[model samples]
Target: MARAFNAKVRQREFYPGNLVLRKVLHIALDFRGKFANKYDGPFVVREVFSGEAIILSDMDGTENALPVNADALKKYYP
Candidate 1:
């Protein structure tokens, strides 16, 4: 099972200063609706870890202490 999963997974890379959209963390905010935005930011990538982790910051420049997995990130072209 693990091999199958690994075979299908592709590595995604992000660089410092690159913009990306992060998956919304649902721990806080009250539920909005089915159509609510499920992702946030065009956040700045602060750093990339050797594995599937990264540090990110919002547009206003606040750095997040938590390291997010690359699976939760999507590249922002603009």
Candidate 2:
């Protein structure tokens, strides 16, 4: 099972200045509804930890107070 999973799993790496979108959780306080967009922000990646944690900043240069898991984000292309 581990081999099968690992075979398909590719590394997810993000660097500072990369654009990314955060996946919005349905249970989050600010979530609108099913019809709302699933992802939020073409936010900028401020820092990337060795672990799966990432720090993101808003387009206006304001950084988020907390670090988000890398799984919750995906690369954004303009």
Candidate 3:
């Protein structure tokens, strides 16, 4: 029962070192606001500070530091 609860809650919490690859992510500030005009490609979780995260793009060879929340991000499991 404990394991089941943990799995359910884990789906809601976003932590550092959480690997997110090849997904359409929306980066925003303060939870709700204007989004970045461009969609970034699959990025790796480099670091998570406070409410911000440092992600590295697969292409273009650039890194972006953006503020995001767990609820504000959705993983495309397709």
Candidate 4:
């Protein structure tokens, strides 16, 4: 079962200066109302860690307080 799950996993990467969106949790959506977005920001990548963690910056150019797990991020296509 573990092998089957691992096989379905795909690898992704991000680099500093790339734009990405962080996943918004369902609980957060409830407070923001029904139309709230499922993802937040084309937040900038301030740093990347071992290909598994990333530091993101707000759009206004301030770094976030914590490193986000790569699994919580997705590349912003636009």
Candidate 5:
């Protein structure tokens, strides 16, 4: 069974260079659930359009591109 992840309800201010991590709960067409997918790691913020952000994940010799919202993501730092 898939676990339910609470959506981010708070809006936060972000810039172009900000880094973020994809929430384990939020799932999109391009990327599957964080727990279901093989690539489970932090992605770098490439661009922000409106409320969606383009992120790049280089995991397991693959570059996965995903679009997510600020509220659907958490700040990621390594």
Candidate 6:
């Protein structure tokens, strides 16, 4: 089972200064039925931890209050 799961999992890595989008949790204020975007921000990668965790900053330069798991983010082009 572990091998099967690992076979399909692609690794995600980010480096400082790269642009990325953050996953948006579907909270009450953000719920918009089925068509809402799943992620937000073209946030800048502020810091990268050892594995599967990172810190991000808004384009305007304010850091987020919490560190996010790498899986909750994806690379952003542009």
lDDT winner among the candidates?
Answer: 2
How big is the positional error of residue 46 in model 5, measured in Å on the Cα after superposition? 0.6
Please report the TM-score between candidate 1 and the true structure: 0.75
- lDDT tens digits, residues 27-68, model 5? 455443344653245655566677465545443334456566
Cα misplacement distance, residue 19 of candidate 6 (Å):
0.5
**In lDDT terms, how accurate is model 5?**
0.56
lDDT of 6 by residue, 1-78 (tens): 999999998877799999999888886764568888888999999898886679899999999978999988899998
Model 6 ranges with Cα > 4 A deviation: 1-5, 29-31
Higher-scoring candidate on TM-score, 3 or 5: 5
Clashes of 1: 0
**Reference-based lDDT, each prediction:** 0.90, 0.91, 0.46, 0.89, 0.56, 0.89
> Residue 21 deviation, candidate 3, in Å?
4.9
Better of 2 and 5 by lDDT: 2
Q: Whole-model lDDT, candidate 6?
A: 0.89
Candidate 3 regions off by >4 Å? 1-7, 11-18, 21-40, 52-56, 74-78
Overall local distance difference test of candidate 2:
0.91
Candidate 3 CA-lDDT value: 0.46
Error of model 6, residue 24, in angstroms: 0.8
What tens digits encode model 1's per-residue C-alpha lDDT throughout 6-52?
A: 99987777999999999887776656766678889889999998887
RMSD of 3: 7.8
Query: Which pairs clash (backbone N, Cα, C closer than 3 Å) in model 2?
Result: none
lDDT of 3 by residue, 1-78 (tens): 999888777434445445444334554453444553333344445555554444443334455655444444444332
Clash pairs of candidate 3?
A: none
Q: Which model, 4 or 6, shows the larger TM-score?
A: 6
Worst 10 residues of 2 by lDDT: 26-35
Candidate 2 C-alpha lDDT tens digits along 2-54? 99999998887899999999998777655455578889999999998888899
> Candidate 6 clashing pairs?
none
